[model samples]
Target: MTSKHSLRNPKDMQYAFSYFYYLIHKKVPFDLDKLWAKEIDINRDGYLNENELRTLAINVFSTPLKPTTFKEFKSDLYKTCMELRHPTPAPVIVEESSSSDSSDSSSSSSESSEDSGSTAAVPVIPATQTATATAVATATATVTATTAPKATTPAVDNNTLEVGQKELEACRIDLEVLKASNKTLMEIHKSYAKRTMYRTSIEGTDEVAFLMVDDNDNSTQTKLDGVRQRRHKFICLNDNINHDKPTAHLVIKVIHDFYESLFPFPSSFELPPGQTNHFRYIHEIIDKKQEENNKNNTFIYIFGVVGVMIVMLMWKRSKRSSNGNHHSINGIIGGVGNKSAAKQRSNKRYMIV
Candidate 1:
């Protein structure tokens, strides 16, 4: 949870947590090293750089990562490696220089002195030089003491380095083996994905055949015959055809006969024919429903047309009745005017008489 690596992106933290969770609790059989080599190592380089690691997360772990997240992951991994190699001290102790380094320096100085004839005897000197001679003798003793621990220090360091290198090499070897195994497994998976007609596994070998025929095609029967003759250990027949095609019924019948020929007798636990006719019944029901829908649509169209015609007839009748009423009223007014004119003529004859 607490990491020295400063990850800027929160998604990166999530990615790390997901990966750690898988490492902690997943019980499924998976080869991480092999999956890494096969899927992530696109360039076939042994090292898993950031890009390769991203690929591994996406393909194997099913974890999608952004660029920033992957960068954080790289940094976190580096931090972990450093921590493993040299763990952080509980109580930090600052030192000006390391004792081992000082020891090494002193030892080198001593060796140089020995090479320059450090053991040569000192010449006899007067009492006046006695003080100086005493000082030189004291410095020599201090150097010898400092150089004493030098030998052990270099030896310890060499041993540690050697052990580390050996362990690293062993780890590399194990990683290579895992990669090889993963590659094999991936190949097996790919073969299965391709649906190979024949496949051989580590435990056993078997032959398989698959045929997908368009039921309406003329070559359907020929392909079925070939399948029957092959007699493979495994055979898969795919009925690929348009369900609404006119020849659908005939094709289904032929396929049914082919299956019946292959398996003449029913197994003891097999369902009865009537019980197994559920899909057929469903298809029949669907067909009847479709017919009903078509009939309903036809009736609706006819009713709409008849309704429009009736409305037009009613409108025409109303218009004709209004026009006839107007003409009859005009004729009655003209007849009244004609009778008044006759009365005026009779009055004019009486005046003349």
Candidate 2:
């Protein structure tokens, strides 16, 4: 059976008493009820009174009383029990009639005492009422003090205000100057973009595209159509030029140098012997000859030789026929010469006869 001073269940009461006892003494006692009766039960009537129950509640919910589990349930139970057992204090009301009567009697007594030239007797207020009044006055003063606005410092002087305005104006001037500078810088950037061109990478090739900037500072990118020549120029001129890669500027320089080397100015202008070997003309002629050699075929050479022999044989036959005709004419003339000699000899014989 639970004791009259205990909670609803004997086990819970024992635990509660033991918990509170440990909180107060910092050690669990052998008998929780004996400790509770000795320390908490002020009247020792074997029952917990209002004060004892409030004390027990405070101990149970004290800051150091940290329960490891069921913390929410313990807090709720504690709050519920505290609300049931220790309700809020009701508002105190003094009788207006009694207060007015006391004030009037005090005033009359003070007037009589003052007329008699005696020290005005002090009004004897009850100790409890005086304490309550003092407490109420203190609370009212604290509330008013907290809610009231703090006294501010005096307004800034004219000199300080003038100085601050001057500083603000200087800052505004600086900001305007910065804005103007920024505008000028943007204009310079626009001009630079219009004058400059960029070379960007091309996909699936080691080649790059040249992006030309227009008058409006807009870019137009185009892939180099003749990449082979440009690549050759890049290989040849990369060592001589400062650029690491082929750009429009570098390509232009290469083309200019190549043209100058091929058809120099003044028509008779010649490069130094050392620089002449770097020109492409010699390399181009050598490459053409190599290409022709690579394209040469045995059958074509044989056909050319046969055609040359046939033409030579036809020329020889025509020459031999003409020679034979000339020799026959000469023999006929010799025969005529023999006949003329005979006719001359016969004339001589006739002359002799």
Candidate 3:
């Protein structure tokens, strides 16, 4: 490929490349062949040289080229090259100066008279060239102003901003509801913690009675009058209750309702022997499951320790074997050296004898 630095003008190359790109995408509004010939073939040679084509390929279309697309590009380029073999003639531009000649002559005469009276000399300029230069400068300035890129700030939509604010407000409302729910749950827990249960004898009767009291305040007390009355105590207390402002009575009622739902009161004031045994059975089952889990965990710990010990024993055995082999090799080498020295001394004594 030709180097980008070798190209005479990068702007012309970019423009020509844009035309080529438009042609490839089938977006050219004008004749592709005519545009390519006019813009790319700067010397009117009617042909794009290797250097020009390489510049277009490297600078303009510098992407990974697919084989099929590249083949299509080469085919279109070949057809355009064959069709535009002959150079077209340049258009002639004629400037008419006859209408302004009289005005120019009068102005020149006045300027000449002024120059003759003055001491300094001024250079004469052609009116026609000055007018042409002014028009060219104005056209260049207009084209530059139009083509130059403008710096723009991205616009933010008010509708999207409003939607975001609405979503944020909804999230805040949800957070408040969650906080209120948490506070209610905490109040329920505190009410349960302050409850007290005990058995007491009525003043004149031999019968014992159970009383459920709320220790949160001294105003509220609940008494189980008799065995028949125990069943409906929770129900009667929960009826006609207001929970919005949980006073001492309301708190006691809520706690009693929560406890009775889990464990209903027995028919007698004293708990039945069967019910007591059932509770003991449940506790024993939980303790047994917990003991089994602890045993399994202990077995796993011992097995891991044994595995580590076995590995360490194997490593020590291998190290001892290697050390024994190295010592044997050193001893064999030392014995061979001593044997050779003894043989050399015996030969030397025999030669002296």
User: Where does model 2 exceed 4 Å of error?
Assistant: 1-217, 221-295, 298-303
Residues 20-102 of candidate 3: C-alpha lDDT, one tens digit per residue: 55544542233334534555345555434444444434323345745454443333443332223322333343333432454
lDDT preference between candidates 1 and 3, better one? 1
Regions of model 1 farther than 4 Å from truth: 1-92, 97-279
Give one digit per residue, the lDDT tens place, for model 2 in 1-353: 24454335534456545655545444232343454446545666554433554454444444453433223322333333333443444434433454445556655765676686746555555557656655665665566556554444222222212122333233222112312334323432343333212333324434442333222211111222243345432221222232444354655554555456544654456655556444456788698778787668666888899999999999999999999999999999999999999999999999999
Ranking by TM-score: 1, 3, 2
Clashing pairs in 1: none
Query: Against the unseen true structure, what C-alpha lDDT does each candidate score?
Result: 0.57, 0.47, 0.49
Name the top TM-score candidate.
1
How should the candidates be ordered by lDDT, best one leading?
1, 3, 2
Q: Say which prediction, candidate 2 or candidate 3, comes out ahead on lDDT.
A: 3
Worst 10-residue lDDT window for candidate 3 reads: 170-179
lDDT of 2: 0.47
Tell me how far the alpha carbon of residue 159 in candidate 1 is from the true structure, in angstroms, after superposition: 38
Put down candidate 1 lDDT per residue, 1-353, tens digits, no spaces.
22544534544465555665655554434445554556656777665544555564454324555655544434434333434444444433334234444445555665666676847653434445555545555666666555443232121121112123333333332234333444434643443233333333432223556777685645777777776887666666765778888888777777777789889999997888778534445789798889999999999999999999999999999999999999999999999999999999999999999
